[model samples]
Target: MGDDVDRIKSRLDVVDIVGDYVKLTRSGRNYKGLCPFHEEKTPSFYVSQERQSWHCFGCGKGGDIFSFVMEKEGLSFPEALSLLARRAGIEIESYRRSDGSGKKTLFDIMEEACSLFRTCMNGDQGSVPRGYLDRRMIPPQVRSSFELGWSPPSWSFMVQYIKKKGISLKDAERCGLVLRGNRGPYDRFRGRVIFPIRDITGRLVAFGGRIVDGDGAKYLNSPETEIYSKRRTLYLIDKAKGAIRNGGHSIIVEGYMDALRLHMEGYPQTVATLGTALTEDQATILKRLADEVFICYDADQAGQTAAIRGMYVLQQAGLSVKVVALPEGKDPDDLLRSDGGKARFNDCLKEALPLVEHHIKLLSPAIKDDRTRKSAIHDLLEGLSNIDVTDVSPYLPSLAALLGIRDFEVLDALERVRSKRRKTDRSFDTEEIPSSLPDEGQQSQEMPPLPEIALISLLWSECDLRRKCDTREVVELLSDPRLKLMASSIMMGESPSSLEKRWLEMGETFQLRVLARGGAYLDEFTQNSDWKWRHFCHLLYRQKGQMRYNELRVKMLKGEATTREIREMEDLRQKLVSQKGS
Candidate 1:
């Protein structure tokens, strides 16, 4: 580990940082959330509030806050550290050693370059870039908002401009805007409308330019420099972050206009990859806001292929990938210009198909030949099997019918292929059970889905259930151990707040033990208005008044009776009834 790493880790708490990114619900002593760096339906991301660290069981991403930022933001070690250090309010002493030697960070240089570029765009002394903006139909307000600028057309423009400002050509070249040429130096983004790319903190670190004439590339971006990686950025994530969080989804488009158009048209959460295929780095950044993402790329062949690759990439990251199948030959920008664009886009979202369905569609067309047709069917089934179909699984039979499979045997065959493919592809870890108790019951009966656990946990933890029942007396008459545990857990946790923390830290293993003792179901109890566990407990306390003695008195004379002990039987019934009353 670097000294900086140790320093930041010592000062910043990972739990606090990770919690800012993902909403963590307390599970025991730890908090659980959907991993922001991976695609997962249920949360496997665990953050230890006690230890101030996080570990994602799904993707195996684990670390302190600095590590999390570095990995997820695609920032360098120093960059991540600088961010954390600033967050922790760490102050630095001015370095003025006689032999003076401290290096300026990439961020520092990028800052200078951004200012220079902005100056050039905003009528830097003489020449103005406003003419360029006017020609493009981009409103001046839009240009200024996005920090549109220009680099002088002359080769010596940047070299001369920055040299006068104490920035060397060597440093400028490293920032990806200057290159060595026979006639001294040249501006990399000469004669173009510059679109400065910035981080979430508004640090201008790179630039993307559009050529004014038939010039070179349509879009020329800064090469990978110390501070900027083209593949690691999206065009306007900083602006879209709040929108993404509010919408609970992010729509990734293909170009700058697509993003701007969407945002300008009220879909503020839309974003675009910076002239490259979606990178895990970018996906990780988006993961901070939403678990579900819609890829609304262009509908060309290249776009379709890009969609497929992005789907797999994000799926591996644990995000649910939905492909917004746009109309043929249209991009988000193209469609947004249509008369009914918004409605069309929404219809697309409503019709958005899962990755597996898209995969099936891709394979369906090629299944013309008999042998290849069989292969295609198996392939489609394999893809289908990966889907957690409990939610959408019912569609399988309807889809089978659509496929014209009327016979049960043909349907069974497809299902079999699906099962086989699932077994082959999944290779995911089987959770290990250390004891016989959990294993025995699991072996005997199919274990309930963990999604149900998530649903129950949400309900049990947050909902005010008093509105559900009629009265305290009726609730007290309810019998079910699981329901009672739910009642107790909620009521007990409500008292101290520390009890909630203690409950959070308990491991899943212990939780499973509690669940196994019939505490998994919530059918055991009921409640009504003004109903609280304490209130119910008060009811139970008073109601247990009579039934305790009759059964015990009979049990005393019941002998150490055999399995057929009538007294013991009566006692058990009375005991159960007493438990119910409570």
Candidate 2:
């Protein structure tokens, strides 16, 4: 197992694995990017190529490639090991327990189902599916690339095929590929063209079947299984992620055909929500890839509603959202099939309205009466308040003018909404105790000076420089308990060569503070390591003097200070005073 891990690590680069998920830029000896684990305005995440590690100063989630993948993909260590090993082309030694194999069983079944669907689509029984595709104007190359498939109209056909392949009937049912009936098991998809849905890593996990010659519902999707989640999965993300990264934006469509049509028309940065409302999971995935999103749903009421909801979700996830308005009564598929379709589509995309503007237009028609206009304005204000916008100055004036209110009034309304949300959010807290409040013993004490924060960041980040300083005394002087704990661990020789590994072992509070304030001494340290070392020494001694003075003052208050203690305290206080004057 260790050998497989070593081989995988040797083949894979930390930058390569993380860069695929984030847009990292070179910074000094490391790489920096906006942290993917949380929403932040500035870049606080750093990746060190030399150490082969990554850390986020903002959220404080850092680790090796294995831990990073495990957190990002929500997999266990063993699962991440298997996944990364496969990606690195290192076959795993199968000495594991049966539970690990059980987890991959459903994924294997899903893959086999996709293979069967593809084989059946290319055979003689695929005539109907082929005719449907021909009518839809999908070329041979597009069909082959997407692996479009067909399922024949017959009960027990797929079940028998899986049984013949030595797959258990229970396992097939577990994957939602077949349903057990009174007589026997039957395929869930029949007489439909299959659109295989893969995860972001291109692993087949589910299917969306559109009926071609049936009297039932027009569309059907595989039931939620261990390997497939409708809310978390976005169709074609595996293929679209690269294009999205290159384009610096993502275009979300409504259906599978709409997404496929956009790709066919040279817009490969498009994905579909697979006929569901936009979900937080999907929005989060999009936000990690690009900062901007364009919603190109159909031009009907339902589509417009979905676009508005999606815009809200994306904006809440800190994405810059725009709404592309298609011609009346036309979807992306319909528009792409029309005359000069690609040109018209490009024009629409170029004219896509910002989400806020599009939302105003959407509500304009209902603002005829005073009551309706007031309600519309209220809704718009509520939406604006929910947005994770950095500079509301540019938006506030326009919003005030639109509502015929003063700018300050608009600000007040927004603050009111936000304040109420904060209160409500706090009310729903499930933690046994409030965390942000200081401890009872700390109520009378002030926090350590800000220079201590800078010193901590410096020692934690710079290795060679930290080796020159008195790390033990510095740890003892830290007032913040979390920082003290982290520094103490380092002082006790629990340091890992990889900074990311060290960060992962630190408490969450410590990690966040490091990311938020750790780089305070970066400029000074880089400009002159000697000056930084002297600066830390000066600050550490000053803190020590202040602590001693405080201790003497308390003893004096209790009338228990001896003459020698009083004289020493006075000397320490004078030294601090002279240093401050200098």
Candidate 3:
């Protein structure tokens, strides 16, 4: 496996691989491009040919080719390896166990099931599904491209077919293709038109089945399996990725057919959530592909409620979101099927409402009674407060008018909600603060001393200085636990670029910290002599020892320190005195 990975890496150049996703221009020794991982206008993302690595100074994301692909395509390490191996024309040795939990094998099973379903749809038994398609005016090309299929009504048919194909019954069950009964195994999907659910890389992972003739649920989807996670998977994302990127936006729909019809009707940048509500994971996937998202859900009350949840998810993911409310009693599929529906839908897209506005507009109908209206207005304002938008003040007048409330009342409500959130929301970044400091209500903790900050910043920016510095020692000198963990990772031989990427994954807070403060002291430390660096290190060690001594004294004063801790504090005090004398 290592040899295979090495072979794949040797065949695929980092610049070329990254260039496929981001346009790169030569900047001295490295290539530079706007980061695809974040919304940046300037080309702060650099590709270093010398190291075969890429890093974004603005967003702090940096990594080797595998990490890059994993972050860019949102795949696990194994998945990225498989994708790159396939791209480089290298085959990976099966990393699967004998019991068959390997994703690759599961993917193969799903693909085979899809093929069987398609064949069954095209066979003599496909008349009902084919007729339904025809009556819906679905073109042949759409059917072919989407690989739409049908499952026979008989439960034993798929079992026999799998047996004929020599597929494992256990594997079939793992893929949710069949269910084992007391008598025998039966097909999970029966008398239904099948739509295969694939990941963004076009790997078959699951299926969504719509009933053609049945008494059970009208639609059923494959249960969550090892290979398929509905929250992270969107229908047609594999086909819609390019169009989504090209259009700089994505159109989110409610149903598979709605997405398919929109794509056929000249809107290729559309996807569906497979009947699940929009999730943070799905929103994140879309945000990576596009900056804006327009939700075109059914215009009924249920759809409106769903649209609100979807909007909140997308907005919280930092993508600009809009809602396209279709005419009452219609969906994207219905609209596309009607005369001039395409033009009307296009107009609707143009007139899509900003998320907050749409939420208020949809909620206004519940204003029949004063108490109900006030409650709805309160919910609306609370939601608005949570949005990361900078200037909700501009929308307040409109919101006030919609709620039939005074402008001052709206402004006061916004202020109170925002203030409450600010007080209560302790973001992940807050965890990085020094443990010695009191929590939120106390005096603001000062930044770590300049010398300590300078030393860390220097280690991050200068390769030579970093190699000379004992990173484990540096980790001990830092007061912040997050910073200590970061330094310890470097000491463990992980590259600073890789750590930067990990910090980016931590969230926007760390990224901003790195951009604003982590690299700021680089010049000061880099230009200084080796002795000055050593002197700063001594100072850091002394300061940390004193801090430890003080903490132990506090514990002793509170009668919380053990006998061992008291002795350790005395030893630290002596060490600090000796160090001061030196």
For every candidate structure, what is the RMSD over all alpha carbons to the true structure, in angstroms?
A: 14.4, 12.5, 14.5
CA lDDT scores, all candidates in order = 0.62, 0.77, 0.77
lDDT at position 356, candidate 3:
79
What's model 1's overall lDDT?
Answer: 0.62
Q: Write the per-residue lDDT of candidate 3 for residues 157-212, one digit (tens) a residue.
A: 88998899888899889899999999989999999999998877567888999998
Q: Residue 487 lDDT in model 2?
A: 67
Rank by TM-score, descending?
Answer: 2, 3, 1
- Residue lDDT tens for model 2, 152-212: 9987789889988898889888888899888878889988999999887666788999999
Error of 2 at 507 (Å): 19
TM-score of candidate 1 against the unseen true structure: 0.56
- Please report how far candidate 1 places residue 336 from its true position, in Å: 2.7
Q: Please tell me which model should have the higher TM-score, number 1 or number 2.
A: 2
Q: Which residue runs does candidate 1 get wrong by more than 4 Å?
A: 1-104, 124-137, 181-184, 200-202, 338-340, 359-582
TM-score-better candidate, 2 vs 3: 2
Q: lDDT of model 1 at residue 160?
A: 79
